[model samples]
Target: MSIHFTVSGLTRNLFHSLGLDNQRAPRPLNPEQSLLLECYLAGQIPESAWNDYVFETPELARHVNARRSQH
Candidate 1:
């Protein structure tokens, strides 16, 4: 047996099962990360949560920092 991924880079079966696409899937954020980033980008996350949140998901900090440096 063989498996094939679609143009979006995910297996067609997995895409259908997850109901998420590259565009719809959060950019720079892995699917495993919680939706906290969605809220963070929207500025909804409280200051109190920033420390713990970034500590648990440091990649988010790195991604944002890199984008800041590029511009």
Candidate 2:
């Protein structure tokens, strides 16, 4: 049987090939969280919405903060 790779599996392989193994593993986001993140990045959401999203999705909040620090 052939092996099927998910998006994340492909991402890991790409990272490894690029010698970026030390990177933190990606966190899986639910549908709602993903949409919220997209909106936040696009500046389509308000601060109040972001605050509530952070409270509800603490893990994603940490991930977002880490990305911010990198930039």
Candidate 3:
């Protein structure tokens, strides 16, 4: 007996197992948002300011929260 697995088939199976197959793609950050997030993650931005910015930017908040959860 022999078995074969195509790259596309393996990739699709992996994504499905990880629950990423149906999840909506993450939104890309704008230039300003990207800079702010980088600063925040690097501890250059204070928590107060980051909190305020996240409150006003739902997309950024989601990104931040996801990163936090990973750690």
Candidate 4:
């Protein structure tokens, strides 16, 4: 048997493997960091929380960064 991942990159495939393809999967919002923006837009998170929540999970980091570049 074989598995077919519709995603087209190594990073993307890894993300799927990690179950972070969904928005609710608890992944980082941006790669470089969204500290100031998130704090201004929403609120601040604790230091430990930031460490826990912020990570370049799977395809999320690459995909999001790519899209941002287009704008």
> By summed lDDT, which 10 consecutive residues of candidate 1 come out lowest?
18-27
State how far residue 40 of model 2 sits from its true place (Å). Answer: 0.6
User: Against the true structure, what is each candidate's TM-score?
Assistant: 0.43, 0.51, 0.56, 0.24
The residue-by-residue lDDT of candidate 4 on 41-62, one tens digit each, is 3546555554444362334344
Give the alpha carbon lDDT tens digit for every residue of 1-71 in model 3. 99999999999989867857545445889999999998999999999998899779857766776677779
The 10-residue segment with the lowest total lDDT in model 2: 17-26
Backbone clashes in each candidate structure, one number apiece?
0, 0, 0, 0
The 0-to-1 C-alpha lDDT of every candidate, in the order given, reads 0.60, 0.74, 0.80, 0.49
C-alpha lDDT of residue 43 in model 3: 98
Ranking according to TM-score, highest score first: 3, 2, 1, 4
When summed lDDT is taken over every stretch of 10 residues in candidate 3, the lowest stretch is 17-26
lDDT digits (tens) for residues 1-71 of candidate 2: 89877999998889867747535655888888778787887799888988888777766665676567778
Stretches of candidate 3 off by over 4 Å are 1-25
Candidate 1 — which residues are off by over 4 angstroms? 1-28, 32-34, 69-71
Judged by lDDT against the true structure, how good is candidate 2?
0.74
- Please identify which of the two predictions, 2 or 4, would achieve the higher TM-score against the true structure: 2
| CA lDDT, candidate 4, residue 12 | 78
